[model samples]
Each structure stands twice: as structure tokens, then as C-alpha cells.
Target: MEIIHHHNLAMKTEEEKLPPLIQAIAAREIAGFDNANNLHLHDLKISILDANEEQKQVSISMPSSPIEVHVGSSTLYPMSDSAAKFHSQPIPNNNKLKYQRFDSFKTWSGKLERQISNLRGKPCEIHENDDIENLPLDRFFDALEGPELDTLRASEEIILPENEKWPFLLRFPISTFGICLGVSSQAIMWKALATSDSTKFLHVTPEINLALWLVAAALVAAVSAVYSLKVIFYFEAVRREYFHPVRVNFFFAPLVAVVFLAIGAPPPVAGKLHSAAWYALMAPILCLEVKIYGQWMSGGQRRLSKVANPSNHLAVVGNFAGAVLGAAMGLKEGPVFFFAVGLAHYVVLFVTLYQRLPTNETLPKELHPVFFLFVAAPSTAAVAWTEIRDSFDHGSRIAYFIALFLYFSLAVRVNFFRGFRFSLAWWAYTFPMTGAAVATMKYADAVPGAGTRLLAVTLCGVATVAVAALLVATVVHACVLKDLFPNDMAIAISGKRPKMTRKWRHRYRRRSSSSSSTTDSDYCQGN
Candidate 1:
């Protein structure tokens, strides 16, 4: 538990004969247990009050979890009498310095080997927390050496496991989607949709600007309604016990949820879509971890425990990048509104699959078919609309169909080639999910002249039964796995029951008020 900056300090605990010059911290302060034998230590608290200017000696100690703070300024050199002298800076007498990594140390570590590189240097002065939620520590260290890292300590509540840094080790892909959402295709589509609808525009109003606003709001509202309803339905599935927030997303995923209105915030900054979605996707994950952290901090409200992993967070990063790509391509030709809405729907599909996989947790053989549904979902959504749009206007040359056809087919083959085996149940479940996407196309198009009309309906029917069965089976499975649940599935009940919980608390308080009054009277009479 002796946390030292340079590799000059061996991993061995306090083996030196001389007392540390500063003794800035002690082992007992950080790890309360005399766990001098454990592989790694936690509870990294060190007091560095003993810096001796005359001796140029300093010491710092912290658990090697969350962050590894390295003090580049400190230096150690071997003495003639089997002792090591410590210095605050590179010794002038010996211009050559040693660079330490973990255990062993090498001599002279010349300027080039010991050189520091900061490619993504901060242009402006480092603000207190310009990007608290997205600290980008690697970028920070890349900009400054170990000594400078101390100046950039974060105030944000980072929730990563041991040996990681918040905003840096976190795998959330917020920037990508946030940027995409900021420059949302839906916005452009509404503008185009209005311009294209010349007849309606002419009929609308005397004021040209007013008419423009109406069209913009109408199309925006239409697409927004679609995505909002999507969120509602997906959550309702969980509310109805079809999805378990904890069991599905037991690990902290990144923020992948596009919760535009939930926090009532402005459109995310460019490049933040990916990061935001990662954070959103991991919202449940983080809260779940917070519960673990809470129990530990509170000395165990419950003796039971929940294992932590970063599966969903990694998935959010992957999917946020993926969702953005799907959105950009999906909207390239069709009404951007349709493309964004379609991509948003695909997000729902991912949220479901994400419920099953870790953010980057390797896929299990049993979940192989899941990849088909994974590849097929966005591809199919992109294709379904293109198929309809193509049928109505033979002249329509939108290449969505070709792109989706090629992309998904290639993706599926890649997954299979990668040797990810799917269980028979996956085939049984996914083909139906695939069928639902097929059937979903027909529901939107019933025109007589449409070439894809009948085929769409046929796919719709097949997918309907498949999706229904999958939904039923999924819901049952989500509810039945109590071990997967937080507090035995507390994530489910804790998720949507926040308000209901408040109401129940109020009711309990009211009843307690009267019961206490009666008890007081009885006590007085007894007295």
C-alpha cells in the first residue's frame, strides 16, 4: 500500500532501512486491515505532511485503484552505504535521471527516453471542469507529465472499477451521437419535407415566415413524437415486467439513451451524441453500481452483493458509434425524418440486445443468433422504408436498399466467421425478430401499385408472430431471474416506482402520525 510515483520505489512494502524523509502518508491510513498480504489494496488515503526541504525527500501513498497518481518530480538514487537518497527534482550533479514504471529501474533514461509528449494539449487554461463528465485523462496526461496531472484532479463523481480513471477509462461514446443528434437529420428533413410540400405550403398562410415555422414544427413534432413514443413503449415493456433493468443491464453501460427531454437540457454539443448515449445507456448501470458503493459505504444495508462489469458501457460506446453511422446512412436519401426515426427504432432494438450483452463483454455461444438480429435490425429498418419508397416511385434512386443489403449481409457473415456460435433458441428467437421487421414494412404501405406491398404484408405477418413470441418469452425471462435483479430485481421495481414509492412513503407517514398519537395517549394512561 506504499503508493510511490517512480518505479524506483519497489512494489515491496517499506523495505528500506531509513525512515521516509516526509512520511507524508502511512499504510494504516489507507487500507485499515493489515492486508499486507492481499494482491492489491483499496481505500487509498495518505497524509503527505512531511516534505523535508533540506533532505529533498517526499513520500505519497494511496491505493492503486481508480487512479495511479505518479509524482514525476520525486527522484531516488542509490547511496554508497547501501542507502538510497531521495530528491524533489533531477539532481544537478547528475543531469541524467531514471524513469520508473512498475518494479525495476534503469540508469540514465536520457531526455529522449524520458521525454514527455502532449499531442492533444489543452489550448486554453485548464478550467475547473470544462468537461467534468468527459475528462479525457489520457489526453490530459498526453498533454502534461505526471507532475502536471496533480493540477487536474477531477471533482466529478466517477464510478469506474479499480485501476481505472473516470472520463478516461470510461468507454462511453457520447461525443459521436451527441454530435449527430445536435446536427440531427430530422432537423434537415423537416426543412426539406416542407420545401418539397409546395402545395401545402401555398395553402397555409399569409405570412411566409409563419408558414415556414408551422411546417418545421409539424415535421419536427411528428418525428419527435415517434421517438418519444418509442422510449415510452420500450420502458413500458420493462414496466410490464418484460425487461429487467438490472438483470439486462447489470453492469454499468455508457450513456446511450437519447433522453432529450428527461433532463430538459439543450441539444447536446457536437460530438457529444456518442458520449451522451453512452452515459444514458449506462444510467441504470451507474445507479446499480451506486447501490453497491452505497451498501459498502453504509457498512452493508444488505449482506448480499452484485458483481460489477462494464459490459453495457462498452456496448453503449460501440452502439452509439453504430447508431450514428446507421442514422447518417439511413437518412442519406429518404426523408431524414424517416431515417432518424428509423434509426431511433433501431436504438430500441439495441437497447433490447444490450440488455443481454455486456458493453464489451465477449458474446457467449448461446447468444450467437443475437448478432443476426443485431446486424439485421438497423439494416432491415433502413431497408424496409427504402423498399416502400422505391415501390411507390420507380424513379426513386435512393441507394438505401443496396447499402443495407450489402452491409447487413456482410456483417452477418463476419459475425458467423468470427466463430460466435448461437444456440438453437437464438435461431428460434431471432428469425422471428427478423420476421417482425419484415412484417413491420407492410403495415406502413398498402398502396395498390406498390410492388413490395404484398411481400411487405407477408413479412409483417411472419414477423408479427415471431416478435410476439420473442416479446412474451423475453418478458417472462426478465421477470423470472431474481438473482439478476438488484435487491432481487430491485432495478425493475426501483426503476419506474420512484414516484409510486414517494406516494407510499407519504401514506406510511400519515398512518404513522395517527398511530404514534394513539400510542402516546396509551402511554400517558399507563403512566
Candidate 2:
């Protein structure tokens, strides 16, 4: 029996080159044969085709005899030119490979195209040389252009997802309650100026005080309604803010604003409403005081030294403010109780801040406005003591002097107050300034003199002007600029990535990359 075997292998490249394709075919054929096999060939022929479609052939005729053939096998597996090129290249690490898979899938499914289209008119360029698989995470961000780049450049700002119905509202921060606190405190200061006998010369009328209180009430109602919506819609954000070291202090501001409204209630509305409001809010304030004061004294993550900053004075100021409202409502024991707790904590906080303990976290320069809080606590305490005793005696005067000294000290460092762009934090200046002014009015009433009267008038004027300026600036920022609710600190602390940016598109890339061990927790904690 005679058997003949004819094997044909065809290979082609984009260029349709003859030499490389023939070499690949030969390699594949030789690799298939075992070294131990013996074969006899009568005729051997090789054929090649070039890009032009022209064929060249070679033929060899062997002698009419059976020829033994033994071919050695190759250790390396044979591959086509393209496969060889891919295999020869260096393999990326697991992280890069994972990102490559994700990018490939995103591109295949057209999700990437949909995202780019959602950017509207923003221009993005992908160069021909750019390998999406091998692109560095940072370089990918750098390649982004137009308004998309601007959105990333604004480090404090973030774009909300398209699915969100009210993106602007979601960005609102808990610190915005400081606005209510400042405005209501201003109403109180104006009422003090209008009602007090010593300052009757300033011509502050009942109508002016009434208007301020009305405006403050309107602001408080508006802010409360908006924040209630935020709490319902974004409870996780609210929960994170509640646990924040600095921001948790501002939770006291909303309650304090209500208390101020009750204390400074216009003559037309002061009778039963003031007492009812005070009684309703008293329990929550004391409960918060116990939880916060306990945390401070217990020595843990929320300990005083770890979290102490000028903002902690907000929690201190609330107690004194509540004490003043209690005294006004004819509650004797409750007023003294609140006053005692406030005084005890204020001393420890004051000394902690004054000594600048190494363990204490420091505030960013943009938040330096809260330093005025040093003035707020003592001044509120002085007023609280005066209300509790029904007279501005030695104890009230001592606290008032400390506040006055700190106010002047902070006032001289003009550079500290200036240079920062307007923010919700600027409201920190208003309530504290108003508190100091209220204390000064008490001082002027206690000791009538030219110097004391002038100082009283000056502080009241400054507080009024500061509150007015901040109010106007906040309006313009919200209406014209439309950037009043970026929630910088909240976003930073909560570890939520900004939406609609390329940075978040490859979040998995960042996670998988061994070179980038940074996590959301690390980023949030570091900030």
C-alpha cells in the first residue's frame, strides 16, 4: 500500500508580505511533526504569494526510493507574526490588566461613549498614539479638556450625578446652620441695643428691632425647611456630618438660633411663645451636652485633645445661650444648671486652645474665622451669668474682660481675617461678634462711662455691618455665582468621589494598582 500526505498552510498579514508569512507556515509545520517520526517523501514543493497576487513555486523530485526522515521538535511553541509580537511584549501587573479589561468592556458596551456625550459640549481628545490600556491614571486625567478639566481643577467643587433630582440641595453642608445662628444672634444684639436704657442715645427703635427679628425668623424657617429635606434625602451625608469632629459642633447652632429667636422675640410675640419654645428645646440641648461632654472627658477618639479647636466653643456657647433663655423664662434651677455645665467646659476648652496642645487638631486658614468663637463663649457666659444673677457683678465682668481682650487680640491680626474668599464659614464671624457686642452692652450698662459707651456702640456697629455684608454676599453667591453649596469638608470627610469625572470612571483602576495603595479611608482620614 502506498500513502501520500499533502499539508497546506496559508497565512496572511495586513501588508500581505511573502517572507514572514512563509516563515510562519514553515515553523508551524515543523513544530507539528514529532522528532521520532520517520517519513518518506517522493516530491517536495514550496509555493509563495506576494501582495501583488503573483505566485512563485519551487519543486524538488527525489530518487525513486523510500527516504527516512527524522525531524527534531522545537521546545518553543510556534505562533503567527501578530501573536508573536503580542507574546514578546512585557505583561502588565494585575492592576493594569484589570483596568485594561474594564476599559475594554466599557468601550465594547458603549458606556464610555454615553458618558462622554453626557458632558454636552465639553471637548475631549483621544490621540491615535494613546493606548487606553496602558494610560497612566494621572495622565488620563491630564488628557481631559475644556469644562470637564475645569470641574476637576476646582478641588473643592464636585459635579453631581445626572440621576439626582436636586444636585444642588444635596451639596448643602450642616455648617450652613451657622447662618441662622449669626442672623438670630444679630437680632438679639439689636434688641439689646434698642431696649437697654444706657444705649437709648443710639436711637435704635422698637420697629428696627422688630424687623431684624422678623427677618431672622424668616431665615431660620427657610434654612430649617431646606435642611429637613436634606436630612430626609441624604441621611448618610447627615450622619457623616454628625460624626465629624469640627462639623458636629455646628449641630448646636440650629438649636441656639431657635433659643436666640425666643430670647429676642419682639414685644408683640414674647409672652407665651418664648416660654413654650424654651421648654420644647431644653431637653435636646441638655442631652447633646451630656453626650458631647462625656465624650470629651472619657478620653477616646472624640476626646478633647484630639478634637479641640476654636469651633468646639460652639458647643460651649450653646449652654450659655440656653442658660440666658432659661433665666429670661423665669426658670431658676435650670438656668444655673446650664450655666454651671457651660462654665466648666469653657475653662477646659479655653485653656486647651490657649496652650495649643500638641495633640489638638488645627484648623485650616480658611476656617480661621472660627477663632472669633473664642470671643463668643466667654461673652455668652458673661451674659448668662448676668441673667442668672440679675446683675452684672464681678463674675460677669471677669468673663466680659477675657472676651474683650481676645477680641482685640484677634482684631489686630488683620491679615488673619482678610485674604480668604467668602464662604459659609465667614458666618463664623457674625454670631461671635454679636455675642461680644451684647456683652459690651451689658458692660456699658453696668459701668456707665464715655469709653465704655463708645466701645459698646463700636462693637454693635461692627456686628451689624458684618452680618449685613455676609447676608448680601451669601445671596449673590447662591443666586448669581450658583456655588454656595459645594460641601467641601463634607465631601472630603465622607470619601465620596465627585460625579461625572474621568477620575471616578476608573476608580477600580486606582484600587487595583499596587503603585496606588491610596484608599477612600486614607484620603478621607488624611484630609
Candidate 3:
């Protein structure tokens, strides 16, 4: 072993230049060192499954091959004297830290984390998992057959790899940045890349323009995330007072669903149906509201009336905000489709906003004010797009439809999740709908562009596998609906609780009118 130090970029030092003291630190993963996911803490002897080009050519690879590495503990693998010394130090106990049983290598570490963490009975499974542990060098090398192998040599210096990169410590920064213009840049980034403009020439402003696109994408990604967070927070905040009757109840869920249906809705019959599909959006909102707010109607009227829930009111604000944002983003880049997509979304929001009807046909002061302002968000979003649609390209329009689905589906249930918990069946279908939207944008006869139309397809495929893995796990008590508000569900549909059961009616008729209330209360004590 030998050692060499350099002060300039062009300098080189081979492994032979390091002394044994330094060489000891450079050996491939040593037993008891960190593993890929930081899930387990243990050490194992290495066996080469593959090697990188540089490693294949080298007499010895960095973190000398065939050495054991630790899993739960931190250790230096560079073999540098400084790193070796760094690895040898002992770490203190952290009661708060828990780890999963990491297999040490896999493409979907998040799933692995979820599985293992569940096995260990926890959510997040890392304590102090910061360590440059090495995997079997050969296996690691064999995996990187593309430019992604070294694509981010410089970026990885500070940022670790997500599934977006190799190894799984890095996460797609959804939380770090917030939404700005509308829709996250990830969707917009795909739109931009797929829709190449003649203006994007190589000799002209390629570098400058490309940089702008990337920066713009990062900003949008941040914005979309923030928008999601904001919507969910608002929903949760508004629902604080009412936790019964599944009050909010999928306020915007069906909207994502309609985006997919839009593809199939292209036929003349389909067009009329999809165009008029606003009825589907009206059901849940109108039903829930009639139950919640329209309780005072007379017998005949109550039978026909309904009430709206508190959280849905808030969702009206959040989801419509998203629709506006989505349409706005597509406005400049797309045309007819953006407006059409937005109009479709506005229908959903409008339905949700005024979902309730009075049982007795009597007007409530709150309904007009809440529904009016609530309707404003989607209305403004819709009109904005309709007015600007001519300037937007068809590609933007298609993307806008997909954007509508993603925004409406992702966070709607968090506030109103009851019977419709994390439904894999829902996501499985929704994902493909999103993909179809990307395709519609890609092939919509507007500007020509290439897109990862297959990205969402691939995701849909993955989701299929995931659904199989999904378990019917329910934590919240289903009885909350009955226990908290026994009449809510019935009220939503019938505009009133079902007429007292036949037996109760018969018994009440036989009882004295004066004691009717007391006798009925005793008869249905639990309810």
C-alpha cells in the first residue's frame, strides 16, 4: 500500500500509493458497518458480483473487494487515514433510533423500508444512518449499465441517490420545495421535455434555455408539493370540529377518475356523456351535504333534502385552487385541451361546492355564502383557462387533464378518508388515466415532442404489483360513523333519517302521544 496527496484537479493517486494504515480504511464494506438502507446493523464478507469500468481496470477497487462491512454501524470505506480514524470511533446509543432488516441491495428500498419497518413495528427506520457503507463492488458495478452510472458524480458529492439515483437514501424532494405557478414541475418537466419547440435549437440559446427549463422545473416541483401540503392542512384544520359521519367523504376523488374517463370520452356518445359527466361529481357532495346541513325539513320535504359537511367546504377551496393552478400552468403551453380539461375539473368543483340541498326546500344563509365563495375558486380557474385556451397548445391541454387527476386524487382522502381508505384499486386505475393524459398531450397533433408516455404506464404496472402486496389494514373504527352520528349516512341519501322503522311506528301509534318520545328513546337506547 502507498499514499499520495495532490493539490490540483489533474493530479492522480493510485491505490498502490497508500500505506496499510490508509489501505485499511479503503477496503470494501467491513463487517458491522452500514448497509444500503441502514435497515440492519451487522457485517458480512464481500463477494464480487460485478465491477465498474474504473474498478475493472484497477488492480484493486476502492473499499478493497472481498472485505466485510458493517450494516448498522458507521464506518469509513475510502481507506483514507482520516476516514479510517473516523470509522473506528464508537457511536452512542440512541433510544429513538430503530432500523429495518435491510437485504442490503434492491431497487425499491422504500417498499423494503415499509415492509421491514412494519415487521419491526415502526414507521421510519433510521436512527443515525449516515455512513458511507459499501456493497459488493462487483454487483454494484454490474447494475449501472447506462450513463446514470456516473451521471451525477458531482451531484452525489453532497446529495445521496434516491430511486431517482442508485441506492435509496435520497428522497424525491416533494417536501423540501413548494408549488409556485401551478402543478409541480415534475409534471411540467415531463411536459416540457416531451414538447420540444423549434426555439430550442442547439446553436442559439441551448445552454441558457435548457438551464431555464430545468430551473423552472425545480421551482414548479416545489410549488406543486406545497400546494398538496396546503390543501391537506386546510382540510385537516377545517375538520377539527367534526370527526363523525365521515363528513368530508372523498370530496374531489372522482375528479381524478374523470380524467381517465376523458380518454374514453372522446367518441361522440362519449363526448356528450363526458361533457355531461358533471352529474357524477354532484352525487357525493350533494349527498353528504343534504345529510349534514339540511336536517330541519318537514317529513315530506326532509325525505327529499340533503346537507353539506364542514370539511367538504374547505376541500372546495383547496381542490379548486389546484384546478386553477393546473389550468394556469397549461395555459401558455397548451390550447383547447387546457380549457376543456379545466372546464371538466370546474364541473367537479362546482358539484362539490353546492353538493347539498335542503330537506324542506328551505334556504340556509350559510349555504349561499359558503357555496358562492367556494364556487369562486373553480369558476375563476375555469374562466381563466377558457379565456386563455386559444393561446395554449394542445399539449398543455392534455397535460392539464392529467394534472387535474393527480391534484384531485392525491390528498382528497386524507381529510375525509373513511370507507374509502388507501384503496389500491383506486390508484391502479387512476395511474393509467394519468398516463393516457400524457399520451393525449404527446400525440394531440400540436407541436411534436417525445415523452415518457410509458412512465405512468410503468407506474401503473408497478401499482398493480403493489396492490397485490397491499393488505386490508384498518386502524380507525368503522363504527365511528354510527357511534358519532347514527343518522348521517341515511340523511345524505334520503334527506332525512329513514322514517322510523315500521315496528317503531307501529309501537309509537299504539303508545300515548305524551309518552311517545320517552318510549321511543327507551326502545332504541343504543342508537
Candidate 4:
């Protein structure tokens, strides 16, 4: 190859310049060369390219395109030696001439490093997953997409993505209580269909029995999946326990226990053992609920302002759930105690949440689960009242009527969820619908009239369909889209609790900080 040199620019005589031996040493000292053959061709090309812009234009279109060169508003191409010069006329700095290389090589090498590193993962795009709605799968599929399968196999530790600095895994919302609520709802339906003597459920043929068992199996599978998520939520995210308002969801544990107890064990399993297991679990959950409610009540009327949406009804639902299970277990006083506490607090919360408009921006309308609470509390109360009072009396009638009214109100406004993104909050629809159905069945059995029976059948069918839709949506979003949780890692990591202020301000600040601090949302978009 032809070489470029600054021989003509030399001010010294031939003898004044060092011999080849000394030059080799100088090259080694300046650029760390290992041999006389070693050359800084890239630096030479850049310096040469800088020497004369007019000359670079000629180089751009030539055969020397083997080596890439970048020029202003031009493509990268190789340059000839003729386009290079080791030393040129003085460079201008601060509008004055300064003859210097100015350590520009470091800057050039650093830029190259950045460009090269960026190229590695850009070319291979992950193929888009198939549309979930088209897939034929069961609800068990919902648990398939959490944390990578490879990561789980490789290590027991949860290796969160870089942006997941939050203390919890994905599914960390208080609305997750709805998962247990959903299981309980299904379990309640199963119990009603298999055991109720009403005309609506009289066709308990072999096929119906098999279908009910299938529903039971689905309930069991769903509970296990949701419980695994809970372990990730509570155990891995130990610090999040301090997120006080969300603590209300802990009631879901007891509610789950109630469902299991209500279902009882199969023929082979000892019923007493099953009862003991549920009792063991519910005992702590009940105590914890007491402590948590005490803390909130201690805060008094001022704390009432911090109450979340209708989802807060899980607090009352928990007590009602416990009451149902307790009454089944023959614990008379416990059921009545739980029923009284649940009913009183729920009424207070209902009035409070009803008067308070949804002013928080942190909860987008699409993701909001609070409205379902309207149906949930009264329906749960009615079910609990039947179990506690041993009949669907006037009190149960009142609770069922109230829930029916709320259910119709929300049903008329079902368009709200159309614009909403799929979230764990959607599970909110399941349990409440089931609660209403269970309440309706109890009402039907008591009244034994055509109108009551028809309403009971209608409610049962609607609840079944609603729960089925929610289960399918959950499977699609959780298993297919892998979008069970929003990217709230930043808020969780910030560990910033909201001060008792206007709900909107607190919510706005939370969302702003979350978006600014992380790219967690981008991961969801990619999936």
C-alpha cells in the first residue's frame, strides 16, 4: 500500500531526523507498537480526512472503499493515503491558531466503542407472539408466563430484569385479592349447584356432576397459581408490607381459607384434617385483619380520606367470608362476631367511598376495580347472613336487594371497561358476581316463587359467564401477552408513601415519579 508522510513539511535536515531504529522506539513509546510493521492506520485516516475537506470528496467515490470513513452529511467509505497527512497546518481554536493533535484519538475511539456496542442486539427482532384471543387454552395457562422459565430453572432467586428495582414481582397490586375472591366465587357456585335442592339446580345429572368437578379442579388450580404469586408478593417483597393501604388485601388469605373449608375435602381425605388446615390459615389472617383495621381506625376520620376505591370492601368481604366458613364449621359466636364487624365497617366504607368521587389519577379508569366493590360487599353480607342466621331472612333479603341494585348500575355502565387495559383488577368482576349469584340462590330457596327462581337462574348464568370471561382474559393477558402488572417498579422502589392530602395530587406525584425513573413500561410493550 502507498504510505502518506509529512516529509515535505519537515523543517530539519535529513541528518537531524532520527534514524529508523530511533523512530521505531519513538513509535513504540507514543502508540505502544509491538513491531515496526504495526501502524495506526485508523488515526492516520482520520487525521488525513481532517487535513483537507476538498480532497476527502474525491476519496469518498474511489476504490479505497475497503476502509470506512465518515464525513459530514456523507456515507462511510474508505480513503486513500493521498487523503491523509500526519501533520498539517495549525488548527483554529477560540478563533486563534493552535498547532496540536489535542488528544482527539480518545474521543474518536470512545465514539466507536459506543457505536459498536449498540449494534449487537439491534438486528434480531423477537417475533411477535400469536394473538391470545385465537388460542384455545385453559385457565391453567395463565401461570405459564411469569418470570422466565429459564431463570426459574437456573436459580431459585428471582432474577428480575434490570429495570425492576421494585421490591415486588409483577402482580403486586392490592386488587390481587380478587384472585382468591375469584376462586371462592367459583367454589361457592360449585357448592350451590351440587348441594342446593332448588328446582334451578335439580338436574344434577352425571354430566352436571362431572362439570361441577371440572369447575372444582379449575378452582383448585387457580388458587394454587394465585398463591404462588402471593408468595412472590409477600416473601420476596417483604418491604412492601409497609405499604399500609395495600395491607387490606392480606384479608384475601383468610377468604381463601374460607373457600377451601366450605368446599371441604374429597371422600378419601379426612374432613377434620382439611378443617384444621383451613382453621390454621384463617386464624392468623383474622388476627392480622383485626390489627390492621385497628391501626386504620386509630387514624380516625382523618384516615378515612385516604381510603381507596370500592376495592376496599375486601376488608368487609374478608369478615363475611370468615363468617360463612365459621358458621359451616359450627363456630356460632365467631360467625356472628365476624358478621357484625364486617357489616358495620362495610356500611361506613360504602357511604364514604360512594360520596367520594374517584379523584386519583394513579388509578386510571381502565384499571380501576373499585366499582365492583359495590356489588361485592352486600352480596358477601347476604351469603354470610344466610350461613350465620341459618335462613335467607329479612336481613339477607335487604343485602341481596342492595347488591342487585349495584350490580345493575355497573352492568348498565359496562362500557367503562372497554377502554381499560387488561389488569389483575379485572378479577374484581368474578367474586362479586359469584357472591350475587350465591345470594340469589339463597333468596330463591327462601321465596320458592317463579319470579325469584327465574332471577336466581338468570343471576347464576350471568355470574358464570362473567367469571368465564374474566378467566379467559386473565389467561390471555397473563399467559399470552405477559401483561399481568403495570410497570410500577419505580413507585415500589421509591418506597414513597402518600401523605394525607388531596387524592389527585398524591396519585399524580406517584405516577410522575414512576414514569420518570424507569423503562419498565417498555418491557411490557415489547412483550
All candidates: TM-score: 0.24, 0.65, 0.22, 0.61
Q: For each candidate, what is the lDDT?
A: 0.31, 0.68, 0.31, 0.54
Which lDDT tens digits does candidate 2 get at residues 1-527? 12222211233334444243232223234332222144343445555455456665544333333333333442332432232211111334486533332222122323355457568765445432122233232321332211111113222232222232334445777778899999899889888988886798988888887888999999999999998886665554565466655567778888888988988888778766646677688788888888889989998657887667677888888889989988987889888988898898999998988988333233444566877888998999999999999999999999999999999998887766665577887898998899999999999999999898999999999998999999999999999997776634332221232354676556535533522243333324434
Residue 456 displacement in candidate 1 (angstroms): 3.6
Record all residue pairs in model 4 with backbone atoms less than 3 Å apart, i.e. clashing: 48-84, 67-78
Error of 2 at 359 (Å): 5.2
lDDT top scorer: 2
Candidates arranged by TM-score, highest first: 2, 4, 1, 3
In the range 286-350, model 4's lDDT, one tens digit per residue, is: 77667656755777321544544455676677778777777766677877887888888887778
lDDT of 3: 0.31
The per-candidate count of clashes, in order, stands at 48, 0, 53, 2
The better candidate by lDDT, 1 or 2, is 2
Which regions of candidate 3 deviate over 4 angstroms? 1-246, 249-447, 450-527
TM-score of 2: 0.65
Model 1, 1-527: lDDT tens digits are 34555443542223432455632223233444234454354333223321221232223222334333244444433222222212122224432212111001111222222233223452333223211222232333222111111111121121112242212101111111222221122232222222322223224232433333344344335434543443343332222221222223312211322321111122233224444453444345345544543442354212112212222222222232333333423333323333444355345435544464322233333333334434333433433444445442321222234323433453455334334321122322333233233322323332333444444444434444544454454345436641111111111111111233566667656754664575455434423
lDDT of 3 by residue, 227-287 (tens): 3553443222123113222222333333322322222221233234432344344345445
